[model samples]
Target: MSSSTPVWPAGHDRRVLAEVDSTNAEAARIAATLAGPTWILALRQTAGRGRRGRAWNDPPGNFAATLAIPSGAAPAQAALRSFVAALALADALTQATARPEAISLKWPNDVLLNGAKVAGILLETTGQGGTPGPLAIGIGVNLSHAPDPGTLEPEAKAPTSVLSATGAAIDPESFLDLLAPAFARWEATLRQHGFAPLRRAFLDRAARFGEPITARTLRETLTGTFTDIDETGALVLTTAKGPVAVQAADIFF
Candidate 1:
């Protein structure tokens, strides 16, 4: 699988391989049994997933990869793990387009490219032993062909593709090569330094903040303006009662 190329991240050992199982599924299964950052990157995924357990679109050559991490992370950090991956993905797309401003971070784990959904991050977890044991970050980037944007979900807004956005074709290998290492730095940063700086930057670059929107949390749906994103990645919404810090929510603009 190694071409005339540097591996993803350049130096980190890549356990790059294909699998029939969903990348998230494979990551969860092996998270406890495997070593660190063993990536399950496949050219095809039969049962891909997205936030809120939605069926994620799986087109060939698109990135369906996840990284297995060690077994010692705080619940709050673990709860907000996607932020690390989100930041990493933003950096990756920025490299591909050379337009960092064009790529923005969506709360939770979505990646917005030029205001459209270019990618998303999903985390799979298993009980290893600690606060949050086995953790795997599953990321999917629209690198190539896809269903017409018109067919996307009702809530899905301005959709786009890398090949379309940057006006250049992007190879999955090239994208990963650029993403993996950049991801490690952000991932490690979140693990060590909490998410204050990253959260701030993420909010600043966030496409939608302080705007009236709808959110579906574990509890129920709420319509409010996005007021703040706290350090723990909890979204603060100006709800009817007052300001509520959201732990997890499926947001809609």
Candidate 2:
């Protein structure tokens, strides 16, 4: 991490838990009562989860936390914070490693270090009566350990850890100190300037940009050139037939 101390964002509450089933679940449970944005950190996450209902292996010494933010925007607008999270994540990793060139953001919600998967993000919102509620932005980083490759699905990118990749063994709380402020800055940028700037920033650090990759959805599989993220944050790719915008898919590179 940085040599200087990290400044926690103003007006944000932080809770460090010794153990929890999942930070996201806890965030969902307490979202309604939150007075302001809160960062929940779990030293030991027993039952963490990822996108598509996949089981996330969050060993001790890793980073597993969620930012619970109260919001009333439409799901689509609120969902755009994934980019905010990703950008913040990239910034934190770069700051920790001091090697900006090694940090890159993957499509959807992943962070790559030295071209391997090092972090992932999951977004969920709570609502009532069709009105959007608070949002939980769950983030996990392989700070000290990478799961066994055999445990992952076929064609999944190999996992790496901050310790392995950069020799920086960051404690969960120390990393959070770096992350929470970065997230606050990015969130402010999003609120003031909008997604255009964030999209451009993300694209600048996008992994496999202009590269050929495969996106697999429930109905079909598409292979195309990774192009741009649309206004609504959909993955835009140039396929053999034409350009396609994929709302949800498992991308394989």
Candidate 3:
């Protein structure tokens, strides 16, 4: 299939591929040589991946892309871009479907429509000698098709698609046209004000806050009331022990 061309901002390197092992991997390769805010897009990813090393099934026609950029903030603060990605995607989908109320963001970086997962964001960083390097932000949205319920991993949330949810036959390229600029806007907000306003906007569209939820971390599982994300973007859980700040975890609501 011929790749669709979308206009990108100046100084940005955007590459569209017919097939690849993973867009994130490709972006990482580019980051090694170029000090780029580069975007790598794949029409079909033979071996896509997600957070925590889970396989990301990428069928042709779905959105599979990664944006790699140099890090400007400390490691902890740079991680907040995941939230920026989530908010950008939510905005783009809301505009595409014309259903602002139907779209919402789950904690961390999952985008949902009417409580079903429509897209996911994965952020990976490369560095040398403990020094921060380029950051690759991977995003996969189910535009034309979603995985069958039975095919999803046990930990994965229920999945849906733009076609299924909105009855709109949106393609990956057309979706990028909406997503790229929306992402730029949020990135600019993060650069100017910091996470305070971004956190507020994230909470405004956040789903299932102040509810009982389970957070499965690498060490153990913690159940608590979902309270808020701290100033640095850590998940704040009101557990029996106290408010636990989680830097990374798989959340279940």
* Index of the highest-lDDT prediction: 2
> Can you write out model 3's per-residue Cα lDDT over 1-253, one digit (the tens) per residue?
1143335556667778999999889877777676558778899999999888888888888999998886534688678999989998987887778888999888888999889999999988877677887888999999888998898778788999988888877778778777887788888899899889899999889888888899999999999998998998988999999999988888887
Write one digit per residue (lDDT tens) for candidate 1, span 108-197.
778887788889888767754565677777888888865476667777766678877776567776778877877778777775886787
Candidate 2 Cα RMSD after full superposition onto the native fold (Å): 1.0
Q: Is candidate 1 or candidate 2 better by TM-score?
A: 2
Q: Alpha carbon lDDT of residue 65, candidate 2?
A: 99
Pairs in steric clash, model 1: 9-181
lDDT of 2 by residue, 1-253 (tens): 7798668899999999999999999999988888999999999999999998899999999999999987666888887888999999999988888989999999889999999999999998878898988889999999999999999998888999999999987899999999999999998998899899999999999998999989999999999999999988999999989999998888998
Better model by lDDT, 1 or 3?
3
Clashing residue pairs, backbone N/CA/C < 3 A, model 3:
none
Error of 1 at 71 (Å): 2.1
Candidate 1 similarity to native, TM-score? 0.88
lDDT per model vs. reference = 0.75, 0.92, 0.85
Error of 1 at 239 (Å): 3.5
Worst 10 residues of 3 by lDDT: 1-10
